[model samples]
Target: MQTHPPRSIQLVAIPLVLSTLAGCASPLQPQSSSELQRSMVLAIEREVDQAKAAPERRTLSLQTDLTKLEIRPDHLKIIEDEYSVDGYLAQLGALDTLDSPGLAELLGEDLLGQPTTMVPISLENAIHASTGNNLDVEIARYAPAISEAGVVQAQAAFDWTIFGEAQYQDSNTPQPGQALGGGSAAIVRNASQTTSGSVGVRKDLTSGGSVSITHDLNNNNVESSFFGATPVPNPARTTGVTAQVTQPLLRGFGSDTVLSEVRLARNAERGSVSTLRSQLIATTSDTERAYWNLVLRYKELVIRHKLLQRGIEVRDDIKARRVQDARQAQVADAVARVERRRGDLLTARTNLRIASDQLKSLLNDPNLPVGSEAVILPAHDGIEEELGFSLVEAISDAVTNRPELETALLTIDDATIRETVAKNLRKPRLDLIAQARLVGLADTFGNAYDDTDANRFVDDWILGVSFEQPIGNRAGEAGVRSARLDRMRSVVQYRRAVQGIVLDVKDALNRVFTNHTLIEQSTLSRVAQGEALRSLIVEKELTNAGYSIERLNLELNQQEALAAAELAEASALVAYNTSLVDLYEAMGTTLQRNRIDLVVPDANQLAAGESPMERAGDGQQAGEQDAEGDE
Candidate 1:
């Protein structure tokens, strides 16, 4: 002690000694908490790398080469001969009188043959309406309440029960009696009348036991026919009160066995709630897509209308040229293009109508039905801003939020609870039976009860045990095995659901990326086509180029190209917006994105006349404050 090492040296030496001992005991030491977390992170990264190396991911990397071909403007001048001057004048005069019969026919009447009204709605309003009024959502809303009822039913097993029974009997018998003095026997008649009644209350306990208290009463009148024979208290009354308890010592013991049904029902209710959430997500996504589709169709109609007018102009130019040098085939070709453009316009109109009806169908609003003639016009345009996203974060959100995953997990819990009950049932049935009774006898019912209460009567006590085991226990063993398999199946199902959700998230994200790129490329193509059309028109007007079949064909092609490019650009934008909807849905965040909350009412609430479902933003919800003044 006097030669003790310095404090710093002592600490270093102690640590070294402990380290040496630990190394000698085990070559591999347990990791610290921080080290374990680092290892888990590295494992996740490796798994992500492996997933990215999949064939589908590789396919996404391959790109289509789209090279823009440049067109050089032709520098040519037409000599103004008398015939050309006459043709130019003729074209100028015919421009005003040109008529497109095909277009006129299309615009003359409604395609659906119904009076129509245009109702403009925004994306948020559409989603909100669908969540509130969609038939699918309404149908799913009942499931959670039904499952809650099942929970109530399961819990009802433990409620107290009251029972009562009363019976009366009369009997007469004739018997031969022998005298005690050894004389000849005489025929005798014995008659009795009895009244009995019992009343009790019983209740089951969570500990796999039952306790019952019963009160029993009996009154009897008897007569004996014998010489010099009499009975004391010929009419007798008896009252007995018993308290009994039967507790299972082995099979059916414990809360796990007694409350298994209640636990399973609760799990079912959770699953139903998830199902409702999934329905809401689906409805929101569908409504958004339908709304965007209506917008796309409306834009396409405008493009087609312009394309038809252009065709009419080209036809008029050719007809004017026919006054000088235009051939019959040239005019016919121009007319054919006009007819085609008109047909496209008609088709676009039909599509717009169909899209409007689809949106109405999803909304199912009282003012907007599928059979209604009202057309839904989108008040909001497609979102054009780029969305920033990370694949890792997206997958994480899907794992945390997807209703299918939640449902799968709840199912596993349900299976586990059942398995516990089955295993408990495999044990031999052993029960402890105990009972205590107090008996009282008196001439009057009130007096008998008074004696029973005062304990002025004989008391009886019973304590016993019961043991039962099925031979071979085959049924019990099979049940345990079945439950074990079911639990394993549920676990596998959960994994499958997780994989499916991940795949859906990835696919939707890919679509969003692809469509965003398409929007950029389509915009460029549209601009290029517009420029080409302008250059062609300017060159023709400045050069006074005489109309011929080849010239007419070039003009028609350019007009078609521009219209197609415009339509493609609009379609791409709409697709990108719809892709976003799909991504949010896949991530189970559609309702959150739309600022809508799904509320599933409980069974009691439903029974009290509350709605089965209420949307958070809907003004109709009870106790909801109206941001706008109430009507």
Candidate 2:
């Protein structure tokens, strides 16, 4: 009637039935979610390579990308409550709207966006901020320039100077006659005009000393009642010249003394630059800590969500069973499930709030556009292969690279230099001064150069040695001793710092190695628990029983295993990052490998001491533990 089935149709029908029978007999293929996560983790490690290569951006953009990673609404619900439904929906909607490349595009836009505000500033900015704006940057910035100006002022001390003056006067000459007559005979007058000029040359001496020579000339005309009866008379000229020198033999209270202060100022300036660099380091470190805290909180929230989802599934199953079982055992199971989910949700919310606070503090801007459903993807997932290097080698690298240690060592050097300078200063100040001058006295400038005869050339010089023990040389000796002690203290501190740094490296290395092992063991445990759960479910289904001893035991065992895996995962994530922090801190360098901008400030530029603001005036420890805490 159907013109006989086609041979191809027959062949397909036969195979279809056989394939169905084969599929029914086969085992389910494993889902391999862990493998997928592992692959993603590997991708992250590769991304870190890029981050290290381009640290100038510091991967804030990458963090944004990570936050944009989509988790289903149900997944989000497990971590949050009904109150957070809108936020979860908003995040999902954003992810959907962006499509495949949306996250990357958003991050790129944020990272490279044009700055809305810009202001011209420099190192002066730091100084002004530190000084609370009352002190102008010019004052501190130009202090060295001003001190240099002192050298110019001292140079003027070596130059010659000339000055000129003129005066006119008129007076009554009949004072004697007026005195005798009691007032009437005062018509006669006397008048006079005088002009004067002087030239001097001063010389600065080599050993904290100076000397000078001076010449003066004057002319005047006068008329008197008793002498001339005329108002004007022939001018009379008078000239005088003198020379003197003073030398210091004890204290350095002259030109050469300037060297000491200049050296100290230069050192101080260097220290300022170091201080700025240190501030920059501190700022970056704080930023990083905030960022990682945000990341950790996100990971914890993810774990809570997983736990919540499992609880929900268990609760639903328990409720369904209770409908048929009519037993308190099923009710208890349902209650336990509800409690677990509720507890997980609360913990997740608390963690989320803490993370948000940390991130907000770091951004330092309330107006920043953060994603509604921000979360940090762990840098890695699952156990990774154990791989590590020697702690001793790590410590050696730390000592060589740590900037704080380097600064401390340089401080010792600076102190030692100061001590040597003090020792040199212990000797009494001595100086020799000499001066040569050509002298002439006349009414005019031309006349002043008229007496240049070789024999008349006045040459005066002095050679002397001065010594003052200062009764005890107390100040100098005390300075030397104190500086030496400081130098010694610095040396000791530097060694101690080295030891501490070594310990830091060792601790980080231990964590890394231990974490690797934990990860491996935890993975095995998780796999075993999953298998045991599956076996228990199969057994329960076959028996068609409720709250049986075998089923309860299996459930309890699986839950314990799940708890262990959760704890291990949390520890692994925290330790992985904390170890990295310790490593970086020990090295005192960023993980970035860029060599383009090679400029680094000298140790002198580091901050001299801890800042008051960073100090804990409240005298409370952030990480203090309870008395019952283990050592």
Candidate 3:
């Protein structure tokens, strides 16, 4: 029996094969994690970004991608399950040239039939999905509601409360005077009963007054014998309504003090809402940046793959040499070049995978379960055009609209309100209190009520004053001092934020202009390298006159030029696009730039609303567009 190491282990053995090439097979040991990671990145880059098929070649050219790459049954299942069946079928159709009926006999069961669809991701979709679903954005969205609830809680302190009470009592007592009278009349009994009910509403006013309106009704019955003369009993009922109000004559006498907590809550709510917007802005920026990075990595992988192919072609050319002048040293150099390009291609592939994973994380859509392990194909591709803006105007816009600045301003307002309250609270406590009551008395409850309504009740008025002072008023004094200091701090913070944003805008603006210039220069450089490589090919004609070293030099020069050109093109694409992301972030307008407005209505409003997130990323896409730029 024989055992084999892991496939990835076999891949790293390419280096070890050099030593064993003197014979046929020498084994290499297991590779380290870092080595594996590098190989994985470069391999993917070479295959995808720098593949042999350009946008035009992909449609008509015969491809072995379906055969070369192992597309497991499970990968097909996951993709098809997520996307439409027809879309999956179309994707499978594109990869499987063997599916044609005549070719089936040769390809056997390897031909694809039902394909899986994978949701393709675009930069626009990524940003929108992140706003609606990213964990950070979702968590931050609750801040406004929490702060609004806090405001409600603070205002509850002054809400009116209705109160009611009812009670009944009975008592009996025996008098000793009855014993001195006679046997039958010896023991005289005294009995009494009373019942009362009251209902009222009490409220604390924001204007520094406390008031209550109450209605009271009572019924009493009494019977007694004195000196053995006689006994009389009757039920007496009283009904009265009373209203009382108290106002602060000095301390706590205005909205500044009485509604201070409510004011603070409202200001805090503004700050919280602004903070939430800031979080969303940051999330949008991150998602955009990650999406573009994925694009760059994909393209870089393509470039690396192309270079590796070129190196392999050169090595094959050397191997095919039939002339006596062909040297072993040239063949060795060609072999070395191929290995170098292959290693680089593998590393590029791994980094591209990393970039894709990052974009998936930012998207964070629940339905997109492929984020865990499956490959994601971007929805759209190709270089994008940009719109320019004035630097001075951009800086002004950032300072005016940045959420951080708004939050700071709100904080300062909150502090100012607190300072006013604290200053007022430091005064000695004094209040003027007053009350009014109407009393109705009668032998029966009905008569008492009638008297109260007929203007026959007695009118009673009461007035009073109260005053108190804390021994040192230390807490009040401290509150005032703290509030003042806090206000100053908030103002400073707001100023600092303004200065920082201005500087950031300037830095981003410069990068945008610089990267744009580089994009143009890189395009020219790619063309120039291509020309230089062609020149080397033309020089091969001169080498035919027996200059063997010149032939070797020409091949090496052409390969180097080709590699440099591809790298420059890929780098230019990344730089120009990423600089745009930086510019958007500096202006603090990521959400706006993406046309993503999460300042959304609540559930009820959304249900009744006219709009939903456009181009929102939902599930794992079904069919992937070709790796080339979107059609």
lDDT scores of the candidates, listed in order = 0.70, 0.44, 0.61
In model 1, the Cα lDDT at residue 33 comes to: 24
What's the CA RMSD of model 1 in angstroms? 13.6
* The candidate that achieves the highest lDDT relative to the unseen native structure: 1
Candidate 3, poorest ten consecutive residues by summed lDDT: 1-10
lDDT of 1 by residue, 181-300 (tens): 787878778888999999999999999999999999999888777542445555778899999999999999998889988888888888899999999999889998898898788667
Tell me model 2's lDDT, rounded to 2 decimals: 0.44
- RMSD after Cα superposition, model 2: 21.7
TM-score of 2: 0.55
Q: Highest TM-score: give the candidate number.
A: 1
Report the number of clashing residue pairs per model: 0, 8, 26
> Model 2 over residues 1-631: C-alpha lDDT tens digits?
0011111100112223223423332111123223322332343233233323332311101011212324444533433332122222234332112121322222122223532111111111211222221112212333434444454555555555554445544444444334434644544456666666666666655445566667766666666665335432246454545565666655554433434444444444545444434444444444444444544454455445545555566556655665565367755765676686667656665675556544433332212213323322222222222233444334445544555654554565466556655665676766544444455444444554565342344544444554456768898889879877886676666556656765676676666666555554554454444445555655767776635534554565565465456556555645554455455555454322111121332323323443222232233221111111212
* Error of model 3, residue 32, in angstroms: 66
> What C-alpha lDDT does candidate 3 achieve relative to the native structure?
0.61
Assess candidate 1 and give its lDDT. 0.70
What candidate 3 gets wrong by more than 4 Å, as runs, is 1-119, 152-158, 170-192, 222-233, 318-337, 370-374, 379-389, 454-460, 541-565, 603-631
Q: What is the Cα-based lDDT of residue 176 in candidate 2? A: 35
* Candidate 2: residue 571 lDDT (0-100): 59
